[model samples]
Target: MQQQTGIQTNPVAALGRSTISFVNSLGDIFLFFLEGVRLIFSSPKQLTKIIRQMYFIGSKSLFVISLIGIFTGMVLGLQGYYTLVKFGSEGLLGAAVSLTLIRELGPVLTAIMITGRAGSSMAAEIGVMRISDQIDALDVMDINPMAYLVSPRIAASILCFPLLTALFDVIGILGGYLTGVTMLGINSGVYFYRIDTSVVMADVAGGFVKALVFGIIVSTISCYQGFNTHKRTDSVGPESVSNSTTAAVVLSCVLTLVSDYVITSFLL
Candidate 1:
């Protein structure tokens, strides 16, 4: 009966277990995040480590972010022009593209891109260190692995994401301009004018807020996943690293989207 019960679990009991597991996971991640933050402000600052992380994360990510932004803007311009032209409101394309990108796509897509580009790498790096006992070596040296490993990453993400988002917005706007003005013959003056009038500081502020929050979430979740990987059971060489990396990327993206919706609901 006990063996059969394992196979045919009670729905209520299963749900309760799942709920508890999820809450516990959240608490673990949250506690880890706080420790990272606290370590950032504690004594013996790791300025060099932090700077290196920033360069690796922010500078390395620029090309991809720009590329994605350009193509995305072009697509938006093409589609938005078609939809607005049908209603004879094609001039509003500037406002539409600007609002869509600045208010939503700019931050969300940039974070997702970073999650793919950097977050996975971070998780894999830490997972590898953990597997190799290098984290233990740091502990033996009396180094706070969380500070050395996690805090710098969190700080880097917080620094990089907003800048990447800003760059994305700029490049995306230019791409939209190329499609709308050069190809479709939108009045350049009217396009810029509409964007200027329609996109206020509030829109920019909201995008930055989203970017900052997304950055923190991605960094912390990725690091936490890497830190918590079970070396003894899960370490199948690179499989463990790759698995943790994949989990980090997936969780970062899900959290970004959910948070985006929640932020938008409250802000807009």
Candidate 2:
């Protein structure tokens, strides 16, 4: 009878345990982020580290961001023109494209791209360090690994995400101009006019806010995953590093999208 009861409740028990584990993980990640942020201000010499990280996370990512932004804008211009033409509203294409890019796509796409590029690199680098005991060596040298590694990344991401998002918005606007004005015969003046009139400071501000939030999410999650590579249950050693990198990228992208929606709701 006891065995029968235990079997019947096993699935329920497993579900409860999983739920608890997930909640605990959330708590841990939050705490980890707090510690990293606190450590960012712990030392005055951190500016050099932050700058190096900025070059890697921001400058190195510029070309790819520009390429993606232009293509995305061009696609929007083409689709928006076709859709609006049906309603005799093709002239509004400029406003549509600009608003869509500024309010939504620009921030979200930039964050996702950076997650794939810099965030993955961050995870892999840290994960390798963990597997190789480089992080432990830092500890032995009396270095605070969190400050030396995680804090600089968080600082760089915070500074870079907004700048990158702004660049993306501008390039995307140009791409739309190429498609709409040069290709589809939209009046160059009307395109500029609509964009100027339609995009307000609020729209731009909201996009930046989203970028900032996404930066925090991506940097923290990637660093956390890498910092704890050895704790991954399904793999060990180098295999764990790979797994952590994959998980960091996937999770950062997901969280960026989720947070996008949440921020949009609040901003709206």
Estimated TM-score per prediction?
0.95, 0.97
- Point to the candidate with the largest lDDT: 2
Q: Write the per-residue lDDT of candidate 2 for residues 102-186, one digit (tens) a residue.
A: 9999999999999999999999999999999999999999999999999999999999999999999999999999999999999
Candidate 1, residues 44-157, lDDT tens digits: the string is: 577778889998899999999999999999999999999999999999989989999999999999999999988998998898898888999999999999989999999889
Candidate 1's TM-score reads 0.95
> Per-prediction RMSD in angstroms?
1.7, 1.4
Residue runs of model 2 more than 4 Å from their true location after superposition: 1-9
C-alpha local distance difference test of each model: 0.91, 0.96
